[model samples]
Target: MAQTAGVKPMAIAGRVALERERCLGMTDAERAWRKQWLKDQVLAANEPVHVEEYWKERINPIRRFYRKPLDVLFDKLTPMLGASRAADYRVITGKLGLIAVGVMAIHYYFKYHGNDWTKKGGWRVTRSKPMVLPGQPGFPYKSERSKDSDYADRGYSKSSLFDGK
Candidate 1:
């Protein structure tokens, strides 16, 4: 990439904020103030900057987005739930929501796809072991008789799906 004369390389985030403020009707003075603020911030923080720390914390795009909506939602619910209760409720619900989604995804994977997955620790049997579906690599059950079956004459198909109960 070549830099043209008079062309400045602002970060993509700064460009987005610029467009957002323009769309939301920012005055020219406000825009000038923002530009000055950015220049001042760059001048103040340019020296002794830790590249590793900046990349670790400030590189996330989602955090930039989630902050606004979460703040808005917290403000809306605070009147009803109180400040402390609202914050606690947000944290609890966020964790529980992530957990529910994870459980549902794992259940779906195991039920539909019978295969082992390689992980950081070791190999894991993500699906049913010795898969019960027909044409699977191994038999689902050992050579023992099924608990639901006692009739020697009846084939395996004779037992109802819920006969164990």
Candidate 2:
């Protein structure tokens, strides 16, 4: 038998078609059952090997679908500025600027005005007094016996106990 040029492998095509068919043929009951099964599998096992395997199997396709476009964009942009300069530009302009803007915006919005949506949702603004340590001036420190004081009186330092020594 002569093979046609530009034709995909039969097994590969068949597998794709089978997958499509299986996806298409999934009834509501089957989907619900699978969802319940997945939930059960996730809940029953602290470390879900099967779910992890399923996710791992999905990774390549998900990566290919999502990362491929970003990779293409990167490849296209890289040469215009050269790789090193492009990478540096991306880090400084893209990552750093995003973080800086996010921090500044959050600081400005929260500091100047309280969150509008939260206020609209009937949230009341409450201020908590700064917790002052013992012997600290200005704010009055409570003399209540706390866990720290109890631990300190036992002749064991808080740092030492935290270090497991």
TM-score of every prediction relative to native: 0.34, 0.27
**Candidate 1 has what TM-score?**
0.34
Give the residue spans of candidate 2 off by over 4 A.
Answer: 1-82, 111-119, 122-126, 138-165
Which 10-residue window of candidate 2 scores lowest in summed lDDT? 115-124
Off by over 4 Å in 1: 1-59, 66-70, 116-165
| Steric collisions counted per model | 0, 0
Q: Write the per-residue lDDT of candidate 1 for residues 37-106, one digit (tens) a residue.
A: 6676665545756586776586586775755566688889999999899999888877887899999988
Range of the 10 consecutive residues with the lowest summed lDDT in candidate 1 = 114-123
Model 2: how far is 2 from its true place, Å?
36
Query: What is each predicted model's overall lDDT from 0 to 1?
Result: 0.63, 0.58
The residue pairs found clashing in candidate 1 are none
Compose the digit string of candidate 2's lDDT tens values, residues 36-138: 7556545544453347567668678766675455456666899898988766765565566669989999777766665333244432355455788767785
